[model samples]
Target chain A: MIRLLAKPVSAVWLLLMLATGLSWWLGLDQGMSSDQQSDYRYISSGLIIIAFIKVRIVIRYFMEVREAPLALKLICDAWLVLVSSAIIYLYCLGPVPVATGG
Target chain B: MTSADCFSAVERKVEIKPHVPGEVGVWVFILGDMLIFGLFFIVFVYYRGLNVELYSHSQATLNQNYGAINTLFLLASSWFVAMAVDDMRNKTVKLAPVFFPLAMLCGLGFGVVKIIEYREKISAGITITSNDFYMYYYIFTGLHFLHVLIGMGVLVFLWRRARFAATQADVRDGAVIEKDMVLIESGASYWHMVDLLWIVLFPLLYLLK
Candidate 1:
């Protein structure tokens, strides 16, 4: 049972690490240019999504939330998904500045 | 019925168990702590998304190589601590001496690398308030470094006790071994939480463009 869980958990982490490496390489190739703002946002969002997915996998599987009681597991899963979605939404909506001078 | 008899009765009824109420209470406290850190992470990413050019420019000031190496160190340490907890659960108390020191070494190594990274950043004229990004960078990683220090201290204390305690016949019995497992598990859980935070922080602060 341990091996069954460990294998996939390690694999997911491996993939996430690889993706991070790739993203870092792309980030370097793109260089520090003002013109690449849009590209950077897109790449960053993608990386965050990948990270969120990996974290969910680890918490649910490796942490054995899957074997936990249904209500407890549901609360954990729901909380993460809700919080992550809200953050992503706010990120997409851009910063809300309070009007002062206007 | 007398005062002396009452005192003896109270002493006899004192609770002793595998789980410490204080330690378990910390786990509950950590939920709120996690929420606060979650908000900081969200805010950091939100601003970074809005001002990608400035943020990436600020990110350039950070050393990705150090960040990457630190991530690897934390990841490996998390695995070692998890294994150590397993060993404790299985009553392999002898292994505690080995794993605890290894885990503490990793924690020390992380602190050294962080100090070097901080020094390099300070020398490069990027103070905490240099920019919005640097502010978040310093606060997040600095708080993490503090936790690492505390965790290392806890590991050392536990390691010393586990080493000497194992030689006791009382500890050889299932009772004390179970208590040791609880302590080890709590420490391992806290270490894992630290590592998990770094995993997210690493990608957000370093790997992202």
Candidate 2:
């Protein structure tokens, strides 16, 4: 029923709001101080992972991938795992240089 | 007269077939589209690694509040479309219009927020040409926004059809149901993809300090 679905949708919105608020609060508390680089990196990484997990839930359940064929579902699941791992790994390793410095 | 009438009624009854086969082609197309986006994602990561400082600097300038809000909007919209698809399957045509617009409105709401964000950023002199960070910021978010717009268009298309088909009788209703479900499912898939991409984009563009 429409009423039933509306509840979950609102709940997800609330969770996202909390996550955003948390990110904003943390970001501001860290201030514009350039000395807090390490703190910023850890906080940003954590937020990214949390957001990733939330998106996965939306895709898997609300998108009805559970009803999709086995192969398609496998592909979808694998894609998320692979992409998330890759991003986290790359983030951990730090950025590459654009070119050789003079 | 009664026996003859019963036999004729049985002979005239039409059989219905499942619409799953036609859906396969569309799914394949969507998968291919996902792969293309996947490649772009990989490239984004590669570049971000090479220019982490610049990218992080660019990200710091992004509005985390807007990014988070848009993420919620897309997530909520995706859920509504899922319900719409479910309602279509259960023969609840009356509910389609309500959920369909709710989904599209969320998508539209995202676009409106994005436009305001873009205007503010541009006024702040942080255009694409501002630096490498701004370049990636614009490219990634702009592409995502374009997909969100397309997803909204798809929902609007389906919503219109559902409205037009609502007045018809049971005989014509079957085809309408099949068409409506197909449209909704396809739109939902695209909408989910939009949400999924944002999940990645949000952290990459906003949270990456």
Candidate with maximal TM-score: 2
DockQ of 1: 0.19
* Candidate 1: chain B TM-score against the reference chain B: 0.84
Estimate the Cα RMSD of every predicted model relative to the unseen true structure.
10.1, 6.9
TM-score of candidate 1 relative to the true fold: 0.76
Show where candidate 2 strays beyond 4 Å: A1-39, A95-102, B1-22, B172-175
**Candidate 2 root-mean-square deviation in Å:** 6.9
- Flag regions of model 1 displaced more than 4 Å: A1-27, A30-39, A57-72, A94-102, B1-23, B168-172
lDDT of 2 at A21: 66
User: Each prediction's DockQ?
Assistant: 0.19, 0.31
Cα error, candidate 1, residue A44 (Å): 1.7
- Give the best candidate by lDDT: 2
lDDT of 2 at B106: 88
Q: List the residue pairs that clash in candidate 2.
A: A95-B49, A96-B49, A96-B50
